[model samples]
Target: MSSDDTHVGLHPDDLDLLERLGRIAAVVDPVPDEVLELGRAAFELHRADALLMSLVADAGAAVRDNGAATASHLVVFELGETSVEVEVARRGEFVRVIGVVMAADQPYAGECRVSLETSASTTTQTLDDGRFAFERVPVGLARLVLDREGDQPMRTPWFDAR
Candidate 1:
């Protein structure tokens, strides 16, 4: 069968098999886009390739859900060898960033600089418990860059506010 045929839909049995396979594969692979596409192709073939078809169907569904789950308004970041947790949230026209820095080792007193590329505003402070929060930022592709004197500045992963 041609790819066009499989794109149409899958047989009931094939769909069931795909769901089961997708569930199992999700445990290991988590996202199975490739598997799903293969299953979709097999479905188009419209041949009685039950075993192969089932595996592919399951993988496809698993990947779909995984993608949806990661789409979030808030993004969190953890740096290596650093005792800090940064949380960024998009609210209407403003983006809020909350930073929690901890003194895991020595006297934890250091300045943190928070910069937002969108607004071109920078906030600096001496960390208390290494924590700081920024509010009233303009929303839209904004980059939150954090920096300390000795340590390198860290950038939060890009995320859409709206």
Candidate 2:
């Protein structure tokens, strides 16, 4: 090892500059609390019993009460062989969730049971051609559950719909 290349500590001037940068960034680019929580939840994605799917896309929040076209959220979840796409819409005080399954490579197991798991309530529906919908759902953190035959049920991550 070269003695010239050895550095034991950060320079005082560099430390001062880093501190100033941090202060500036804290004001200009603060991280949201939800983002931090989502990042923490991402760490549990690979758990053995739970099948976690990544969000492929999202449609930003819509303006409230635009006639019958209420605010809606569309999201897609992707795993290796199975992918699910869902549309969540606000139905006055309640919610409506519509979902479709996209199976990759192998043949699908015909049908699966779909459920909406919310902190306030949980609702179930039967899938027809991998399509299901739930009406009059309550708001809160909810996930889509897919119960399969001879296999562990798949659940989408808890999504907060406030």
Candidate 3:
């Protein structure tokens, strides 16, 4: 009766039972689309030596009396001694993102390139005075990635742009 001494095979009934369990679980507790998207984005490949940034602050955007959204959605991300501050603003049917990179102990004066990535597209901008901006960006799950010459790359966690 020891299975280690013989070859084992799954019966057709076992697969049926597993499928039934999966269906039941799906109905009882299904995974949210947002969670699934974040999970996928989190697993996307980046530089092996890249440092992952942590989201430190996220201030949601405000709505005007006419139901129009205004800018000033501030989001901050940090890793090690470096931090990135971002502002997300709604521009008509799109969004605008502006960011600045900073080092806690000193001014960031390196040649840095920032990229705003989403499931659909990616937009890149070179830092001007440690700042960058992306206008007319699609509204969806997005993230920021920074690459500096001769330095470790950094990336922020995926966030909703809407």
Off by over 4 Å in 2: 1-48, 61-69, 105-109
Please report how far candidate 3 places residue 145 from its true position, in Å. Answer: 0.8
- Once model 1 is optimally superposed onto the true structure by TM-score, how far is the C-alpha of residue 36 displaced, in angstroms? 34
**In candidate 1, residue 40 scores what lDDT?**
52
lDDT of each: 0.48, 0.72, 0.79
lDDT of 1: 0.48
* Per-model TM-score on C-alpha atoms: 0.40, 0.62, 0.68
- Candidate 2 has its poorest 10 consecutive residues by lDDT at 1-10
Residues 32-82 of candidate 3: C-alpha lDDT, one tens digit per residue: 989988877565864446688999999885767477656558899999889
lDDT of 2 by residue, 1-162 (tens): 111223348676766787688889988998998997886576445333756677788774776574565788888887778888888888666677887887884334476787777654567777887788887777666777778877687878877554
Error of 2 at 99 (Å): 1.1
Better of 1 and 3 by TM-score: 3
Our tally of clashes for model 3 stands at: 0
Q: Alpha carbon lDDT of residue 14, candidate 3?
A: 66
For candidate 1, lDDT tens digit of each residue in 17-91? 776887888787775789767855553343232111010110111122434422123344444544444455544
Q: Which parts of model 1 have CA positions greater than 4 angstroms off?
A: 1-73, 102-109, 119-126
